[model samples]
Target: MAGPTILSSPSPPSEEAGTILLETERLIIRRYFLSDAPAMAETGNDTLVTANLRAGFPSPYRLSDAEAFLSTACKPDGTAYPQHNGIFVKPLTADNPSPEPRFIGAVGIIPKGDVYFRTWELGYWLGSASWGKGYATEAIGPFVRWCFDTWPGLNRIEGEAYGSNEASQKVMKKCGFIEEGTRRGAAEKLGVLKDVVNFGLLRSDLEGVKELVRDS
Candidate 1:
């Protein structure tokens, strides 16, 4: 529900889109499939979930939109999304052994361009039922590690939340992202303009956290 400093020299697109389907201790962050459409429709269509997000996330999100999203997300080896390697899908599921996990949320990055090749914009959303759980923070830490591991050139990943989304801001902070700053009235949603709060994690931040983890 709300978006990096990017300054890099022009570089060739990487060899291939990362084939990462990460399994964290509590989450299965992976690609989207046809089966995810219903749950995606359910969560994404909700204004409660989308209230803080961008307009690209349509209100009254239809089954068609989910279908389209899945279709686009599940692109082939040849078909790629518009920007860089495209917004790869990462629909999170509980890591329970029983009662097969369902798609409870989504996460991915929109790669930046121009002077921002080494940076990306991150985004994610969880169902209201999943709120108050540590899922966002839990999912992001590994995702950050995955990005650093998979795309060696990427230096930072950042996200923006509406100034009102304090929960999301806290989630980012808990995941080791720094509170960079805010842009006043930089976004408009539902006929009103709102300020945006920015949060970010850099490769150096990940390295620092890993060192702390090992030290402890």
Candidate 2:
């Protein structure tokens, strides 16, 4: 809980062009920084942390894994999602009024194709210690609104979680996402098949949730 500034991405200016720095009442959703690797490794290495996540996230998440992620995910290049951002706590410093917050999670939406071209898939994960505190709901409510408000081409956003991960569904619901049903046995995590519970949020839904940012 110490930071006078948001950790800036190490990528070159050209590669960091569209990188966003988002702030909420209690969170700072910004670009991943190289210095955050150690913390990322610590959190990413925990099995409980990645339990509900896909296999794409390394199990024994190492410093190298963190390094690689920062390199690619934080780059300004088009490889990463146009709006991928990090989540940090807004901690107060005794000496400084605004210290750089601690990195606690990651969140973003990736656009899709075909008839879904105007839609984006939302994804997010918080470290073990940061859960059950309404951080995800608060961050998501504003993030979803930002996407719809900032980008006119986007009409809808998609989200999915394992049936076992009820917390994720709740966050989605609180943030205005509708339960669209589930894909049975769509994912296998920890040797057990899990259903993928799908959710979607429309630009229209953002209206009712605009107060989320206001309340914050």
Q: State residue 77's C-alpha deviation in candidate 1, in Å.
A: 6.2
Show where candidate 2 strays beyond 4 Å.
1-20, 78-83, 93-98, 213-216
Question: Which of the numbered candidates is closest to the native, going by highest lDDT?
Answer: 2
Query: How big is the positional error of residue 134 in model 1, measured in Å on the Cα after superposition?
Result: 0.8
Weakest ten-residue segment in model 2 by summed lDDT: 4-13
lDDT of 2 by residue, 1-216 (tens): 542222132332233532445577777777666777887888778788789888989999999998888777766644334455678787694322556677777887776756666788998999888888888887888877766656666688989999999999999988888899999998888899999999998888777777764453
> Candidate 1 lDDT (Cα, whole model)?
0.68
TM-score, cand. 2 vs. native: 0.84
After superposition of all CA atoms, the RMSD between model 2 and the true structure is 8.1
Top model by TM-score, which number? 2
Error of 1 at 2 (Å): 32
User: What pairs collide in candidate 2?
Assistant: 3-99, 3-100, 4-99, 4-100, 15-76
| Residue pairs in clash, model 1 | 1-52, 1-53, 2-160, 3-159, 3-160
